[model samples]
Target: MTARTARAVDVPVAGGVLRVGVWDAAPDAPTILAVHGVTSSHLAWQLLAEELPGVRIVAPDLRGRGQSNAVAGPAGMAAHADDLAAVCAHLDIAPALVVAHSMGAFVAVVFAHRHPALVRRLLLVDGGLPLSAPADLSPDELVAAILGPTAARLSMRFADTAAYLRFWRDHPAFAADWSPELEDYLVYDLVPVADGGAALRPATSYATTVEDTVDMNTRPTVTEALDDLAVPTVLVTVPRGLQNETPGLYPPAHLAALLARYPAVEHVAWPEFNHYTVVLSRRGAARLAELVTAQLSLSVA
Candidate 1:
């Protein structure tokens, strides 16, 4: 397959400029506005973009993550949703189909809710629905519980890019599925810290992550979005979690109960893939591209 080059464009928003990756297709091709997960960057969508060469893929490194990491502000669903809206307006692609993974799904949910006129359909991959969290848990505890080792790495320093690559090389989730693309994605997260030489750190702001996690789990926006969804929504779930463990982020029983409450959501389960691989791997991206194309067709039909 031919590789599609993504052009980086900085869009001015409320707080600051947002760096977005645009994979252009034919001028008339359908457009997909993609949002990445917490602690992730627009590079996360590279595989998916490659799989859908006929469609225009626009992904933003949402505030506090990726290239938008320098854009300062309080991060939450409302803030992210608003940023996404600005991206649409800046690109003149409002009312576009939105495909989001992990925490990005939560942001998309609130985005679709707050700006119904800007979203035509919603495709949520492994998130959007509220996860089960202990009510007594503090924000820090909640982030730790949900993110586990992923969150812990935010505070870690790597001697160099090789060391950072080694760190992720040992991660159980990507160990088996590691590829050149994954390596590039990991390298993109490394930023030089003030410690004498270079050190690896997640571009994502820790404070913003905490705030968004708390809002996703405890805020009213997510619940309100689910309660009054205005557009067709589909949720694609994987069998494994971030660590490649069984029962995944959303256990079958738990997801079933949540889906029962929001009957409007259409859920599809793809077994044998973990949360990260569900969108990162070649096979997973192929499947996701198929789903996106199908949904886009449905929207127009």
Candidate 2:
């Protein structure tokens, strides 16, 4: 087995630079693009990158999240889609398989729609379809309804990495699944803040999350992309939600309705994994690696 060497690169985008993590393999290794969930960075794919020994994985921090939070302009699915295209061009690794989790899945859809030639197939984990919510909810309630604690954490300021780690360790989604990798991922999400003290805060922007979240559920961008899905797509869903709650992001009945609408998109129901564990845990990474490996064996051209 080869050691996976990971490195970060800053690629120029519209407003600011996009931070990309490249898990390097052999020169001729198969390359695949990865997209992380809302409020997540390229580090979210670390465990999965290790599981794939001979493949190159390129992932970027979407604008308004992680290191790219400095990126100016409104955050939406189309904007993220364009940034991903820019990442591919900057690295010269286009036309690869896309493995995206949560909001990344939605971005992957728009990516495929906006840059069809750059996408081979899409592997959506625990997301991709619109997650319908009550239309009467206020903006705050809407973000809270979909993101749960994930959104609330954005507003919090921590004293340091240890403080942030403690906060995440208490999270139900990561409590029993704690690992060094999980710690590293959590630590990377924090940046120093100036709240009259040495406080640290998550790199994700709450306003940007609100914007992206609303666009994902209620905007025509997702609808238009789904209407014109032109590549091979496989949607893999988990049975649990972010807080280890049952029914996850895509409940069976709701997902069934979505699948019915986009009949060509294949669905794979994976049991015993929560939304975060689907990409955060080691076992989950191995299973997802198997799926990506299978897709690599096929020719999308």
What TM-score would every model get versus the actual structure?
0.97, 0.97
* Model 2 spans > 4 angstroms off: 1-3
For candidate 1, what is the lDDT? 0.89
| lDDT at 178, model 2 | 84
Q: Candidate 1, residues 1-301: lDDT per residue as tens digits?
A: 4587789999997778999999999988889999999989998889998998888999999998888888876889999999998988898986458999999999999998899999889999999999977687999999999998888889988888888888788888886788888888889887877565655677878888899999999879899988989899999999899889887989988999999999999999999689999888887888998999899899789
Model 1 earns a TM-score of 0.97
Model 2 per-residue lDDT tens digits across residues 145-216: 988888998989888888888788788987677888888888888887755578999999899999999898
lDDT of 2: 0.89
The global C-alpha lDDT for each of the candidates, from Candidate 1 onward, is 0.89, 0.89
